[model samples]
Target chain A: MDLSRISVVVRMRSARQAIDLGFVMACAWWKPLFLSWLIPSALLYFLLTVLFHHQSWVAIWGVWWFKPLLDRAPIYIAGQALFDVKTSPLQCVKALPQLYKSDCLPWLTWRRLSPSRSYDLPVTVLEKLKGKARQSRLRQLHRENANAAICLTMVCIHLEWLLTLGAVGLALLMIPEEINVASQAWFVPQEGPMLWVQSLLSYFAMAFVAPFYTMAGFALYLSRRIDLEGWDIEIRFRHLAAKQARKPAAGLAAACLICFFAGPSFFDPPVWAAEISAQNKGPKSGSASSRAPEYERVKKQILEILAGDDFHKPVMTQGWRLKKRDAENPNGAALPEWFIRFVEFLEQNNAGPNRIAAWFGRGARVLEFLMWSGLAFLTLYLLLRYREGLEAFARNAAAKKQQGHPPNRLFAPDVRPESLPEDVPTQVRRLWQRGAARPALSLLYRATLSKLMHIGDFVFHEGHTEGECLAIVKQSGEAALCDYTMRLTLLWQALAYGHHAPQSEAVEALLTQWEALFQHGQ
Target chain B: MSRIPLDTQYQVETPEGIDLEAALAGPVVRILAYAIDLILRSIVLTVLMIVLFFAGKTGMGLFLVLSFLLEWFYPVLFEVYAGGQTPGKKAMQIAVVNDDLTPICWSPALVRNLLRAADFFPFFYLGGLICMALGSKFQRLGDLAAGSLVIYREPPKAALSLPNRPPRSPQLSLSLEDQVAVIAFTQRHGQLSRARQQELAEILSDVLPCGSDQAVGHLQGIGIWLLGDRGETTSL
Candidate 1:
């Protein structure tokens, strides 16, 4: 494990940032990560679903319980890809034995429900640690990182459920309202098909969240190690060492000498070192160091290679652009001689340009006539199409002048002030006492609508239903009136449509509230 | 293997020749930030609805218009004015910037925020999440459309606390990397465990040939020397 080859920019990061970095890695290698995770998990789900067909919950639970084992594939892929190792889904599937070879039993058993399973899996899988070593290793890693890792697990868990519900919501959106499937029926499916749909949704949701969960844990592990072991510093040092090892001794000494006298921090370390070495070497002989003979040979060979044909290869590229015209004769004649003679003949003719102009004017006049006629015809056609609606609009406009006095009737019953029996609540109570709950609730509802329209200035159109009347009264900005209207409307709906009778006491209570709300019956 | 580079840092050279680097915010943090915004939006809308409940039809009309503005222009106003951070983004310590690493402008901010509808299509940002996961810079559909990026705000530098030691030049010629490591080692004396410091000190035994017990002190001396701290006491 060469620290220099680790792909990510390693630095001390907050736990959330570490998890985010993990998400980035999972996305970058989504193909292999998804492949390795989805294939086996989906297969297990399918098998369990078939076996436990009657109990779909069992299948989902089985799939979920075995997630720790399935998580290994993504963790393996992410770990390998961090070092730029190419891996396929098939390779990940094949490496399952090696991946699951260490500390697998505990993860499947007691550790299965661990909140930080994603963060802890790499410890058992990648490090291959078991027993006491794994415990201490986890302790060290979790010292400062436990909260974030647990938070990541919690967040991903919520995200999984959210995505599942979102997916179900999207499917529900596709079902047209005309289908007449009740909302309760769509959500609370008691049958096998809906159960299967739910299982599949949840399974895919888990599959979606798995890669991010595993990779985030992996990043947390990597970041923790980087902090404890100084991986970033180690990588830089290794690169420096490799550079030094590659350069020959004499050339390095010369480079150091140049930097020593350069008075800048460009080649930082060597300059200071050269100053010390120069002082130690007594200054005079510092400029003269033994040179390797192979230097000139390598330099000449490098120059010869650079001056080779490969370096000067020609690249042909073709495209179109406007042709550059000659500046001295920018508009020089470039027309055909025949076209020029034709133009001269036309100019010489007496009725040449003016005749053409007159012809254009005639054509323009004809087009103008056609356009005006077209507009006039369209207007006539629109008037004819909507003639009945236009007549109704005019009739309604005339009727609005007479509507200063509110409409006497709204519902099927005439709610005229003169038509009502003087004390409406008393009449309703008398009807309720007679056990005629239907007419009693209906009379109360209609009387309220009539009062709202006439006295309270609430506007109820002729076609407004009981529900619409209630809505109008509620929107009238009077709380007590809205409350009374709501109860009366509900009771009216139950009796009218649903054929459910309201209790006598409930009707009496509504009549009392109605009396308090609308004092003057007439 | 994907051709995209696998790193979180997005670096861009500005017209002024300054290299601006930003840590690209990934899905987890971004999702969390968005979740915070979602909660905040829900709360504000809920409060608005309650307040406007008594105003009847006119109140309902005003509520709709206010919610529309809050829904669409909430992020835009914050990003353009509040240093590119919405309230949620500020809490998460992330900000929006142009692809060129400039402060967010009005048009780009509007474009990115408006395209959130597309990103939010079909479900709970599933399309956006997929795009962000696949994009090299973790850019979602809105970001890609608007040429913007969500990046982690640069954290303030930690106060330097090097140990008080006499400066002594390293006996052997050290490379630039070695100097850095030694300086970091000195700076992180209290953070790194004493035993771990001794272990790291042993890696360069040829350069700092002091006993294991005194290696930390010797390295501190060399770190001070590398930092150009002569015998004088410097405020770090």
Candidate 2:
């Protein structure tokens, strides 16, 4: 309302201002927005009941969760408000089918039901983007105002939940006799109108909070856009341009007067205006038309004052300096013997400028050399200390440059894809049977690495340890293969490093599992 | 669907005559981070309960104390010493910092964590949610009182380079500000959609000899030239 206080630059707003603006916006077009929510909410509730076979809990929770879908209506209303388009509540309701098509369906998907979705709703509802474009747009919007949007949504959600609880509690308190009867039956309401009452109460509560919630989120989205695009400044500039455009003739006339005057003095109005006014009002008997002579007289008098002798005169001053002052203490106190000796020593050993320069010059050179060498040493030390990190960075960059092609090594330089035998399980079993336990285990480990790298498409770098490899495999979603790999890796490490070989029977069992796993992969 | 400025970069001038920018995290991310911590805490509690199940009354006593200590001091301890991040915050790629963009100290961490009690008032962090929603910087009441910020720990992205091609200068010599804007546009080209990229380039179509589509490429070439990359061979 106060456009003057609204700056050309978008400013960070107080929480109160944000919420108040959202509230006002909601209040302005509450009817259509509310109806838009009511229609969908009821429909969603009906569909949930029919789909879930009138399961009371599912219907209640499903409707509550589906409140986010109804958010589109208010978002639509707020967005329309930005362009000064005031659609009636009925009109907004009438356009619900279109709104559902463009906005609601895209967001109602399960994957999109997230805290981040709250922020994404405005973009989806207002922008109507799909696929990659939608993704890029969402990323762009998220990069700027994800925090504010998220916070607004979270707060509104909590408020909605709280209000729903309060509404239920209030309803229960109002019907004390019914509640007592329900309590007698273990606080479970009779499977009839009571359930509907409870459901309606929650629905009403959500309806009450929906507009404010949606408005706040929309406000945050607008605020973020304003900050990024400098909309406030753009609006101000546009307004100024429009004003100038409307009065172009007057502006041109002013420009012409300024060009005609063509003097630095013509630009300054106060000085000439004051002089003219003074002449007109002050001079009754005197001739005001001849004021130039009076001005000349005043200028001459000022020049005379400036040119006087006192103006150019320089004053003498005094201060203490080693060369200027006497050797005696300035305060008339006797100086200490040590201080006098120091002064005498300086006086006695008065080296020539060349000698002093040579002494400082040599020291300076040595100091400079030390500084440079020290810096060089520090650089070398740092390079040595973080060599592994630097090497990894270089390796990653190189890997990125290569693009689609996988790296040469899978786990280690020794565990190359080419090195693994074709019949991995059979060869590993034969080797294990021949009492070559470590070799067989190592072969299986290498085979698993190759499987993960080639089959699972897991990227492996040089420095990754066995544990890291296991974690990566686990994260890659081959749960069965990951379990096999973990067991094999753990056994291999124990036998190789700890020399704690497993029993032959256990090895035989593990071999069968390994063969089964590789066979499954085939 | 413009990019939201999610993180506020609070820049502090260090004594070394350099600026360090800290990107402040918003409340939603913070909530996710808190949820992670809650899960972790529950896991720890569950494991302890199972492990100490045989110890009966003594185990129950220890568990109660541990739970109390964990509920109160887990975040505080981690924030003070774990580079201003709890394990949850670390996983979420966020950290708590002093308002001046310094690593949070012990007192502020303690104060902020302790005031979680106040934030938890009237069931399910309702008070904190309200405060966080209303507060600028997405700070809850505790953060406001503690003079601290929870910030996103984002790695600095490398500046994007133009494709390798012969250098092309702008038709009109751009001013320094315009040059910066052009460079920024090129740098952000990867993030923007093709349509959006063309739309933006069209704004400078008057100065560009090429059409909107070609203007985007030419602008990128100019940006490359600005960055001192003249491609394989320099073009006049």
Candidate 3:
């Protein structure tokens, strides 16, 4: 009767609503239902395929469709068990055959064979409606529930397909190389008889996932009913009303009737009640109004009891205390006689100081030798392991030092490899002809940097300088491109820092050579 | 019979006389989180298998042991020690907490993870999914037995302030609940789109002296007044 704990949003739910509920419910019961039904069905399918010596779609389809029959009993039991606190998965399995015979067999008509009938199962199985009444009930339910039933079936089918694929993939992974080679001929398209093994594998996989589809639909049906009819709220109210009806008969009136028939003496007031009545009737009734004196008396008695000698006695008689231990005492308060004797024996056996130091020095020398050798060995191992990587890092660092300026000083961040137009030589020539010497040289420098990064396979760390770029190009061993790049760099340095703009003829010469170098590099 | 409203927010009263509210994660979000974990597990396994390919028989033995430990204990180890979240749950911004909204302990974490065998029944966690959907707090069977709840880590944002216009008293007196609702609507002005804000305000036009078009400004004025910003009263 804890009304506060009850959920308040109950109503007749649609089929879609039922499916949503069913999906989660299936998640909860997935393990037991899967093991007992789906696994066994799959095992049966495997046995059938092996015994018949044929791999047929008929076997796979039989296993898949046969799941509905196997699942009927479990679904019915699980749906009922949802409301019962004590019904376990084992109990449901134990009661399976009875549930199936009572609920599923009666509904095997040709009309009920459609997949959509899975969602209408609870009404048929739980409510026992049939014929026109069942059809009208289903239609009404469908109108309210909407597309949940169809969606549930579709999702389950898709999940089954995915599971089947996964199973096949796993089997392929585990299959022996010899078997795979032998089966290669059968794997070709349209080889029906030869593909029997593949069909058996698929059937086995389908069996593993088939029960979930049936159970999920059942769960959906239950959820839709809960939503539509407020089953939760009804259960709560019924529980409360039943308890209310049972209360008076179980306790108060029955007890009082038994007491009355027992005896008059038994009905007499108790001694404490009589004493209280006598006190109220006395002139000391005014004293009853103030119980301060009684409280004070009790307080005094408690104080007297606390003040007794027994209360002042110490509980702990023995405890360790710190004390100086001289030769006469031999042992401190905290130290036992055996520990003291052990310390004395160790002192007597101690070696002389000089001998101990000499021994220590010899041990230290050996330890130092071992430590140094280990360090040397570790260094050698690392050098051998990463020789190429270390060499590249050293070359980049050396190039950076030789450049004496950051690479960004020559090229701005905005310059990207693709930023250069197709007619780079024409663009540079136009800038130089207009007496934009520095700007024209900058364009050639940017292009060279982009080309070296993209085609030369050079690693450019951040902060690489112009000298570093030149050093990298020279080390790359492209003699002609290196010679062209060197000439361009000297001209750019003269125009940019020395403020000595190059002549039009010199700029023209460099641009023509740059285009030739670029073409050759491509 | 009336339907029972679903309650996603759980309130826990601490010994310190404080209430902590946890917003429970639903089945959809949990499924997404689980999928993320699955992908991560596969990636780890693939990497290990590739690396160990050169190690011969010993490597194969080690690989099997590592896979077994990872499959069984990875979530348990992370959940107990790594602030109640696995990497996937962390990515999804959800966490496991005790039924009382406290940080989870080892026993509960272990129990929940071990029962995953039960949850994973019938292939791809069908049992766990159904249980989570039906349970009041989106609890799987493992969560129920372990006394744990998976909840959104982030708290709901506070309401926005009303526009800075002069306060004016309402033309009509309102019940406490109605007044609170109006104030809440004004508080959420910034979050809602202009059209949405206007539409919401117009719904309360019956209580205002103004027409539906002017209801937005009228509500803001009332909201400011409710905030104790009483000034010269103006008619709409």
Candidate 4:
């Protein structure tokens, strides 16, 4: 009968819609990699290395990749759950367009027999859908924008730390052992006056150099990573799965190879260390020549000029000592911990702070403090100047956002009005078709439903996550039954709006993703 | 963190659509952030100890007192009581948060400040550094013991003109109330307080085309306007 054919057609339409949603769900898996894998994996790598130093190298290696996986899993699960939570008659409104183009009228425009084909659409339908679509779009835009900004902020934070904090750290690392040697009473005094300057140089070095190099290393790393990861693409792909896959992969290969191989190979002192068996090759040979009076005079002049010693301002370690103060009594009973410990430690280690002691008796602490102050001031001055670039960076960011247009993946989901059930009462069909968009939705609710469901289940009784829920259902029955349950579970996750309200676009995305799930046959 | 040229985004779907490219919290990004922190904190702490230790015991005690006092308020008290950081700690993205996991109050400051000794374990902050380098949340010994998190306090966002949103309408012309609502909505986020978010969200929610997007959309539009020629948007 004609009625039977119409019913069959409607069922087929619904089935197609459900299939399209499956593809959408499959696209959502990337979030787990970012939130769960990358950060946590890196974090765990450091954690295991630092905390469980006793662990064998093999364990450390094994744990390295786990963090990146775990880090993203939460977000992956959470984002997917968002799509799965809300189901309603509204979804039919979204599925209609796809059904129209792909199913009912795949080539309606193409069928214009006459050259003068009027391409008029029903204005009323468009007008009604426009409001919903615009609102839906704006919500999607806001969500995407916020997510992008947070990612960018994290990136910038990393970059800033690398430049500023890392700079200071490397500066400190450059400090030599000689500066701390001054506190020892009976050692390292064999040479002469040159030791005093050497001590000062070492102090400045550790106080300033270490932090600088460390920062440089970090900055270099960040800048490179940013170059390779293409985080922006990954973000877009969350909504546009097929498009992301289609995009050319980012180029991280060179940096990885270099960082892992050549970086340490060329720069690691322990690896590339040349034997100093040849005495003439040592810098010590230049030391003797530099000791000449004329050379000393040149060096002194240079020292005074460079004594812009502003770089020596802050010391690196809290316990990092400048040379210990010399006592008035050469034989003054050493009661102070610094002196006692310095003497004891130096003796045990066969080195002395004694050589630099002569320079310490008078105003050395004041001189050192002043040095640090100058360097700190200079760094501030440079940072202020550098801020001009920051303004430009901000301007560029604004421009980038404004110029950006969403890729095809960002298009509104398949739009269609659902067919009303024939057996239902006329009022029921009318009520179902009459969408209650008038209800004011809360963003707190829109953004939070999945979380609510999760916490709800946890608070109520489900011991596992929504993602795990399907697996559990699947395992609980016969194979064929399990498949059916999982499909339903996936659908339920896609459409169960469960007590919370959501923005229309988010809902559309859920519906689209749900359809993709079935369409992809995953 | 400045934007990196190499970073890319991918669309990831949840059961519902949600963004999760940061889902994995990427490698180089996290390591770089931590390394920067470690280097800065280590440098500052080392420098402080070096200065105080060499200053002589009296000088060291004076330095500690000076550090403690420096944390308090006004004329010289910018970072004390609630924010308890030396200049170095502040710059390094480290702060002394309190027991409730919020920023410390002056009294808690007084207690924790006095208790730095208990936190200082066997040699040269071996314990503290261990806690920071090894803990789940990157807590130091003091932070773990104090139940606080040290988060970065970022600089304020730049000022900007908001978007040219025509108030919801049959009417093209804006009434005074509508204009005021838009202004309040746009200016609120820069305030950086949760109270402000709630307050501002109230004003613009009525005028928005989509009630859900009101608060964020208003601000973003404003951001777009302020951006001028840059046309750059902060991407999600």
Candidate 5:
């Protein structure tokens, strides 16, 4: 293609790339933010349980899910860094002129290259051409650019998905076994097919899964982009003739798979697996005895936490407190029956009055309470942030309009009244022949505004009503005598369709007066 | 981007293509434009008032901008954003280009919105109208001092397909004198280089007969191939 057409293509492509890059980065950036909204809370929940109360290792290990901060950060950074690195290639992809300057081509030779054929057409024929030619060229350029941008964006999005999966896995380990197996998390069901869904989720809270997913997604996006760019073809050709490359390929693939899937298996051994193995080796009676005391204490404590009150203690109280119950009545520790039913209705399978009774369960039931309360906090935070995000977005977008238009004395002087030929008095013709006065006024407003603004004049700021604007002009004395000129514009805009002028005709009359004023100014 | 044909300091060029002088003269046609704008706007507003009476707040609310912003800065925004002319400016073959003869942008749009008062004097565009009528090139106050100019955007047309036929042989029948004349004429066509002009002229001259300037004129007078109607055009 010729230089101008090449330039158009390059520019169109670059802009498309910029937009795509922007979108990819935005999505990648948001992933961690969304993850941050959840995982941190889970970790905090598990950590708080460890700190505030002494829990046995078995009970504690059950809730271990999301990985450590160190693992999460590197994975998160990789997406953004990868996003940055991927987009970096686009920056190198610049204007065609710059492309010629790149290392691939010898600069001076390309810069000074000339078109092979000479194009000489008569001015008369060239003048017959229209602006649509330029516009079409621009549009074509944009389309090609948009395609390239789409490819890059898809790569980034795929990487984002992979990373999210890692986070989900890590979240499984951290799932606070209570939130998972016991349906502690709000609005979740604990049984039937829903139970299987619960297990898949529990996998994320299971600790090391996050880093694994993170690495996997990154690898996947890389592989995908490479494939799309046809880099795999180059790779295969490089390998086809070599000695077996399986060892290197297998090593790289294994390392990626292990980091993504097996990295966390090394941390925090499972206590339940040991118990299960031990139970298989011995009698059931022996296994039950071995689990006796410790299980009972945990069950007691977990029940209390679920009930939201201490059932073991009885305190003497005053009149308003009602009778100082003789025993530490466990029944009294529960909420009112109606309130229980209300809470049960909020849960799956709890459509009736007896639903709250379903809360009675083993040690991990505290997860249910934590999950329910967390739901409230999550919803409120999200709503507030969404509103704030909107306001912030607007404020950020409007930061550039303080400068003014160019000054008048910059253009070449002209002697002719109408820039166009007399035969092309478009507005004059429109006034006489175009539809009604509405179109005419619109034409007039446009023609007048264009004519006035072209004389090195400034348009208005958002402020300054016509009256206020006029006063400022009069006070400035720059064009004080300009009043009493064209009144048509204001009359047309303010009271055009009215039965009477209502002070508007006077405005229209002033426009004609402007013709007179100019004569006076000269 | 930005507008085109940026002005340079201390340099005078004979800009035959889209010159500033030519562009500034456009608004001369807009004086009558504003007069029409007045008539149309009045009629529309009158209808609007009746609509408002029947539809009440509902009608006004639906076309809220028409109720307020339309009169306020809608025209200014549209003009600035739409390349200086409203629908009116467009049909009139006028556009509001920057002082340097580039496209309109935000600041210019805002400035026009602000300085709209100066353009409007004594209730009408009396001030601006007069500026266009009496000032040089019929430019209004804004266009005069702002280095801006009202220009026309070229209409769309098909690309030029120049007539080109490779020469059969280098040894054309035409004489050197006719070749020189054709070369000189074609030299002024900017798209072709001097060498290309010479080459084309040589090819065109192939159809001419051996001759002096007078002889070539006589041959053309008799109707040679290159001598079509262009032969009668002596200004070349």
Candidate 6:
């Protein structure tokens, strides 16, 4: 009821601006507003789902139908919060009956689909207006901002759908491509997990949008009232009156008399308030009847002074100015005064126009020459300053010409130098002795591939299969190295895919050949 | 009460000691303005399609190029040259401005508009919408990235044109806020109904002491005085 205590600043805002204000209000009190909205709505969503698990469509319809009722919770919290009322979410829940008591039936049934439902809810819920009075009140409120209210509803509806779909789309993206669930299952799930997920997403979207919609509509309602009632003016006036009420009556007559005669300079409000409060206190100064005529005379004098030239000084001087000259002056001011004057001087010397133009062109040419020469000098300095690095870079590039960068992984296993042990044969032999037969052969195979790629400078791509690796080695025509790779590739393929363990003697033979062919350099 | 006014106004102080304030536009109004821009862009494309139908392949090629440019640069061009307001923004009475509250220049405008693609992620502006709703200043991804803002362009205040009553000072000296209230009352005279005005004026009965019959007129007279309006009899 106290307009000064209203949380939002009262001003004449456009309908859209009003909605934005509502959003700010919602943001400021999101904890309470969203909690009050979410708790009840979420409970109802769960209850409906459990009761009508078979008929999920019913659950969806029920949740959707009860939205008008559910929306009331946030609206109540926001309305209370607007007046600086400290209501917890639990308190808001307990107070829901009071919020829904007035004209609730109409909201659920006939007026459920009202485009401006939130905007009109305040009239019923807060003001407790009902019947013909409510109708008339709505008629009055809807005159200006009805379209904005409708637009708010439309936008919020779209926002809810967008958020829901965005969530679903994000979920779809996160699911690996190999398990590509058809999008149809997401949008139209009749029963089971998908249906439940879809319903939950829909409810979540609705809940998320509820706070913004409710608060925005409430703001529209508040803004409309502000426009109609001048709530801002009332607040300021109330503030003035409050200040006036607090002043003591210490200096009464002296303050008033000085304020009256000395004009605005001596019109200090606190002193005058002390005087007025003293006048209102009793006949300590004078009786009311005796002061009336004197007050009238003072008021008349003040009005007369206000009507003097000091308050209203209207001067009118009509003349013609050179329009073209004024236009030229404005444009001329864009350039520096000296620069304009220099250009004018150049233009005025028309006889030597060609000579002056040549001199200007020559100066421009000299400056361009200086800039280019300086740039060239800088480039040369840079070249000399970093000559060693440049030469090293050239040598590196030439040394590695036409070499495909060593693939980090040969097919699946990492072939990087960092991945390999210093003595590959020793590690493979230890694994074999431990009876980790398949690992021993695979490790030997991987070591061979790594050596081929890094030491032998052989290129392999991620797509290359075991046969392709053997073909690449065969193409290289290194007899001993290619033969060793062929045997390792066969053993790796047999053990890895066929689940067949290789013979220990064959693995030992390969390990010894691998050491001879590869480890010797190391 | 919150010490600061809990409205959506963004304020910054300059080196010159001037406080520059702009009302930060939230997603609702910005969305509406964007919708308007989308419709306008569609209309232009449709019109171009018809006009270029007769020019064959060359015209079709030209149309494609024009559409690309328009799609990306329309907001940028208007923001840079048209006082930071696109046609849709002008209609909405909002404009783009730099974070420092200056008129948006070309570089920022281009950066913000081009990054609209990022804002339109996963689906149509859901990311942007969420960002705006959550952001303290209601800045979308593009706005955050470019350090630009969408703000309500405050309309010029209408001249106070109350009836030419002889000016009257209040019974008590009025404070600055009181003066503003009176001025606002006078400015909104035409917009508010007569009964509403009287009702508002009645609230000031403690100070004015004007009876119910003359309360509205008395407040207006005081408002006129506050606005520096001399009496009707005072000739220029």
Q: What is the C-alpha lDDT of each candidate?
A: 0.80, 0.67, 0.64, 0.36, 0.40, 0.83
Report how far residue B141 has shifted in candidate 1, in Å: 2.0
Candidate 1 residue-wise lDDT at B176: 68
Number of the top candidate by lDDT? 6
Candidate with maximal DockQ: 6
Q: Write the per-residue lDDT of candidate 1 for residues B1-236, one digit (tens) a residue.
A: 54454567788987889998878888877877888998999999999999999999999999999999999999999999998999999988999999998899999999999999889877778779878877778888989998999999957977788898877666544666677877877887776777777877665553344776777789889888888765543332
Clashes of each: 0, 11, 37, 162, 100, 0
Cα lDDT tens digits for candidate 4, A332-356: 5557768888778767875556744
Q: What DockQ was computed for model 2?
A: 0.02
Question: Which stretches of model 1 miss by more than 4 angstroms?
Answer: A86-95, A175-178, A246-259, A262-522, B1-5, B170-179, B193-199, B206-219, B232-236
Please write out the lDDT profile of model 2 over residues A351-457, one tens digit for every residue.
66677688779999999999999999999999999999999999999988888687666546366668878778688779888988888888878777877788778
Over A1-522, each residue of candidate 5 has an lDDT whose tens digit, in order, gives: 111111111110122222222222223333442343245445555565467444333222333322222223333333334434222223322322222222222212341221100000000011122246634433433333333333333433343333334333434556675654442332254445444344334433333223323333333333333322323222222232132244475554333333322223532123323333344456665666675675566557555664674544668775665555535675675568787776666765644545334544532488788998999999988878798787777776664332244545232222133643332234434553543455444444444433444442535443444454344445545553434213544554454445233242443444455444433444
Model 6: CA > 4 A from native:
A188-192, A249-252, A258-522, B1-3, B46-65, B154-164, B190-203, B209-213, B232-236
Winner on TM-score between 3 and 5 is 3
Query: B1-236 in candidate 4: lDDT tens per residue?
Result: 11121112223455556543311112222233445545655665568778878779887887677655433322123235436454544543334454333456655444444444444444333345334433434455545554544444434446654445432211112233333333444443343345544444443343333564455554445433333322322221
- What are the RMSD figures for all models against the true structure? 28.1, 30.4, 28.9, 54.3, 48.0, 27.5
Residue A347 error, candidate 2, Å: 26
Native contacts recovered, each model: 0.35, 0.00, 0.10, 0.00, 0.00, 0.63
lDDT sort, best first: 6, 1, 2, 3, 5, 4
Q: Give residue A236's lDDT in candidate 2 (0 to 100).
A: 41
> Once model 2 is optimally superposed onto the true structure by TM-score, how far is the C-alpha of residue A499 displaced, in angstroms?
93
Point out the higher-scoring one by lDDT: 5 or 6: 6
Positional deviation of residue A186's Cα in model 3 after best superposition, in angstroms: 18
**DockQ of structure 5:** 0.01
DockQ of each: 0.18, 0.02, 0.05, 0.01, 0.01, 0.27
Evaluating just chain A, the predictions reach TM-scores of 0.52, 0.44, 0.39, 0.13, 0.16, 0.50
lDDT of 1: 0.80
Model 5 ranges off by over 4 Å = A1-522, B1-22, B32-47, B57-68, B134-138, B144-147, B156-236
Overall local distance difference test of candidate 6: 0.83
How would you class the docking of model 1?
Answer: incorrect
